[model samples]
Target: MTAPQCPVAHEVFDQQYMRDPYGTYASLHEKGPVHRIMTPEGFPAWLVTGFEETRDALADRRLVRSIEYAGEDYRTLPLPAEFSTKTVATEDGAEHMRLRKFMNKSFAIKRVRALRKRVVELTDGYIDAMGESGETDLMTAIALPLPITITGDIMGVPDEDRANFQYWTDSMLGINTEVVREAGATMLGFLKRLIDDKRTNPGDDIFSDWIAWTDDDGKHLDDHELIGLGFMVLLGGYDTTVGMIGGGMLALLNDRPKLERLRANPEQIPDAVEELLRLYGTAHTGVRRFATEDMTIGGVDIKKGDVVLCSMGAADRDPARFENPDEVDLDRPNLTHIAFGQGPHYCPGSELGRMEIAIAIETLLRRLPNLELAAPADSVQWREAYLIRAPKAIPIRY
Candidate 1:
């Protein structure tokens, strides 16, 4: 079947597009729900945009999500063997649901609800450790540490070992080739050691819980699955939340009045979290999906094996999904955007994710009311990336 005409100025994978896709997404969304684009590897794919259609398309299964289509190489950047495993994002159907079911109990809203106080403690302590610095990088001082510690807490790692694990986790996700390998090796080894330790002396952490967790027929994550799942949670947890904190902080700083409002009433931080997520969700462009069957969507025809790309970054900013979408309104009503994505593949750590961001914004505002951007907005450097995007570093003086 012939696909609809493409609307982007350049292929979605093009470096220029990566730098800024807001304009392209606006143009494409106006055309319809979807349009064809070239993948980072230059392969043809459909970029879903219309808010309703994007949600519908993600819910529909004509496009399968599985490792079968994920070939050896990543679509954009070069991927090492460490990332080759078919994660929850890359898996499909029953296997996907099965894995997700196993995780649901642990990642449920109720479980995360119980973690609220703890999330605050983590956020507060990280801030306390900052002592008395006239200026500090929020990402390093708070954003990066909160989620890293949270991930470590979930995995049952010792407090002392967290800094080491956090370092390698970043390394693996980093673009540096050598750093990636070193991180992969280090993380794998540490997880193995941690797993061995858990076997003998399991504690009340996610890793220990998972070790004892089982299904109706006694299904459980095997050792290999354990390693993969361990790496997956850390990778997803640390970077995504860290990016959210960094990006969200920048958003809040740009709207200092809004930041002040949230600070005045800490109880309002939850609404502030929703608004921040809607305004500054982090994700460069998410992964690609291949059609397993013919499907017509958003006035476009998608054939079997046709690739589908969903950009959470673009979808969150789609004006149709949000009222006054670009503007940050703490009181925005019915605020729902696909920052953590939609459908069954929605980020499992979302509740925890929200809490982390909420606490980060609240603590920083309360403790460092004088927080001022140390770097010029135009002068601030942005890291070049395709899978994830965040400030290279944010300088702030408080």
Candidate 2:
């Protein structure tokens, strides 16, 4: 089938859109669920906006995550070879399931639930360091370090090595291409060494488990696959959780009534966490997928090999699927937002992320009864990245 005539491409991920994307998403939804759009990097892709369409596109087997299916014109984030091989995010079908199976146990509900006391301990320690805070950047003081430390803890990275890992991870994800390349190489080398050590000296951590694990058929991930999985875990576990905690906290601090309600009824924090995720959830865009065959999503025709971006941020706030989609209603019955995405590639660490966020928020509300934004809400700066959504910093007073 031939490609359909495209509409004028809207530059939807520009600086202005980064500041606030929901308005643009609402505008796109009003016209249609899918639209031709230009990414910040100047590549054209189809953007799925409506909640139903976004969810359907995520689950559609016709759309695949492997770059091999992408047309020559499709552009993807640049990654070192070590970072690209055998990752669950880049695989499909049986291979994806196999790769994911190795990680499922570590992030299982029981395992995540077991992590609650440790999460609380870490959170309390961070809050205690704030020392009855007068003012501080929450991102630095808690949001950034908490998740990174937890990731290091779970991966069995030595305490002395965490700072280096954190530096490399931040540089690799930053806007500087040169820094990204250099940091990717450094991080790869570090991961290789870490894996080598884990093989010889296993410990009670995920990395050690992965090193020792083999399926019923006596198969296991090779060094390259282990390296890639290690990189993916570091990125996925650290950045997104940081965003969720920081963004969710910022959202709650701005709404005193909701904050107080959560503080008063700590039990409601779990449900309230769902509402925060719906309103301020990160993972602004889903993994980029290439259409494997001609298909239609939300009445918009997609050509084979075309790039498609499903906007979780847009989908979660879609009015057709959610009443008062923009507002935070803790009582909202339909909490089925695709914040963690859907289908085969759904986030494996979702339970861990949810527990981290819930514990972080609950502890903050309980301890810092007067927590509020130190600076004007509108003055807060947002980090401008194509795939993630989070503030640069959240200044707070308690």
Candidate 3:
């Protein structure tokens, strides 16, 4: 006989819940580490909010990303069929290892580290475009465009094709299933064409590097797999960075003392970046996993085939895990946070993303020493999407 789930007396996607989720999550954490909740997608799921529970569950091999391992009811998500077939997030075991290996090679630390100069140049270009501005939406002027342009350039996307790329990326990141499917298919088609171009005109970029990578048997990722990989790189790094940089800047702007501290010590940008991510990282929906077997987490029973959403935001703010969970402590120890995720699906672009973020912070503070929010923090709008949490526009004045 199985134990019944412990449903919380709260809603996950309540309008107030979406606007500011930390306090609500903290309250939920007090009730229990794991709660039975409905996903924003309307699926019944287990939500793990405790720090230890989230870390352990993330590392658990029995809880997988592969939809094939999902229970019959869980498999009925309204996603496109192709979503379950490929992509790093939907794979498990040796197959996931294979895709991860390909990605690891393409985004090797050395390779990403080498891009620092180019990233700086790109960052500077965007700052230059700001032109000592009176006011501008940083989300548009800097935060959003920088990563998209960089990802586009790395993927060998031509300048003329970038607007379409951005459109598809925006559409795909939304909560609407039909919009996501249509945008996904469109992006995949565009990626296929881009990959075809790389086949003939290889260059010094990630796409070209992937084109050159081949496994032992003289085999390489087929066109479909390549398309999946391309989508993974582009989508994975885009909006997440946008939210981090934009929300992160807003966080600092709202807290002038810390902003001054960081400005006084530019070298602290790295630590500040990590702290910001821990506090204000994107991905409110968190990562989803399907249980391959019955499991007990945080003293709660989670049955096999149960869908789990690990709240990275809640985990990072867990009082038991950090000394000052709510405060932005730049001097905090380099404690591992699941902001970039954990285990097999850890973000491949983490280092690159971190570099971009650090550069964004340092560049902004240096170039626009008087930079401040153009509007009240409460008045700024946030995107209401399930997967990504970010402000629609971070209005800033310098």
Candidate 4:
């Protein structure tokens, strides 16, 4: 009889980890740079801990990021075939490159820089709204909507459809419930129509650019590919920036001095953004890569088809790379965290995300100098889903 599998890891639930995964991350890293574990939802996975090793493993081509690479037995995992084929996140090798290349032109940092003024204006509006409320749940009221609005703005999603996009993103990023799945269908349909509209009547927005985009080979995005890319971007753009603004707010509020520091020296906020990203940084829960060939990363013997889950949260706290890995230091140098997965999958939207978040925080301080958390930190409700982590509600008083 086969013995029960004892995967080497610190078994953790999503809620517990979501609430405070740090101590667990620290404890797990002690076992080795790479830890084999099961998630709260009973998913078999490995979490990479050391920063360098984590970065290297993310780039390892042998570990294909999709259900298909795991072969027939992977059917036990319950992934739909359409999901396996349609999304760039699930593609590897030439496919990943092809999908990413079509997007590169529209997502350049220059394009992000061009959107700065509009982002600032949106930030101003959110702040204005928050001021009227006097006390507000920063996550929902400001942090959340800023990125959603920005993404809609970039993609040129109609105003009527923007909030529904946020709802779909929340579902996709968190638990894949019926709400998420149904909303996803609606969103996909909408993007397909949007892409068609762009094809017929093109505009300057990134979505329009994507709809008309071609790679080096003169290939364009198919409908399914376009839908997948647009879906991924909405979640990616909204969540990372939302986390940055909301999570960064929490981190800064934890220190009145940090709050005042940014107010006094706005220049410090840029570095503060990096430090915030390092600490409360996101894009944390990402896809599981199945090894295409037997290989070792971070000194672990990864068998062919073994699933490796990349946890930026654990990697960001690697003590070997960052002194007092758990602490957030605005002045830390040579800091590179996996907030965006490194290598080929490095987030294409980093510039726009950072700019929107920084401007939000900067504007928040400027507009509401007297802001403080309305509730204690522990009272904040966090997201419990496996794929992404954030507070469900973050209340603050001005």
Task: Give the number of the best model, judged by TM-score.
Answer: 2
Q: Model 3, residue 246: what's the lDDT?
A: 85
Over 4 Å off, model 2: 1-10, 164-171, 174-176
Q: Please, what is the TM-score per model?
A: 0.87, 0.95, 0.94, 0.91
lDDT of each: 0.73, 0.84, 0.81, 0.75
Q: After superposition, how far is residue 331 of candidate 3 from its true place, in Å?
A: 2.2
Candidate 3 lDDT over 48-109, as tens digits, reads 88889898888889999877767765634344445446777788888888888888887788
List runs of model 1 lying over 4 Å from the truth. Answer: 1-4, 7-11, 30-32, 69-86, 158-186
Residues 126-201, candidate 4: write the lDDT tens digits: 7776555478788877888888888888888888888786566666555445555676667667777888888888
Decide which is better by lDDT, 1 or 2. 2
In model 2, the Cα lDDT at residue 11 comes to 49
Using lDDT, rank the candidates from best to worst: 2, 3, 4, 1
Which runs of model 3 end up more than 4 angstroms from their true locations? 1-10, 75-80
- Candidate 1 residues 212-295, lDDT tens each? 888576977777667766777887777788888988888778777877877788998888888878767776466677777777
Against the hidden true structure, what lDDT does model 2 obtain?
Answer: 0.84
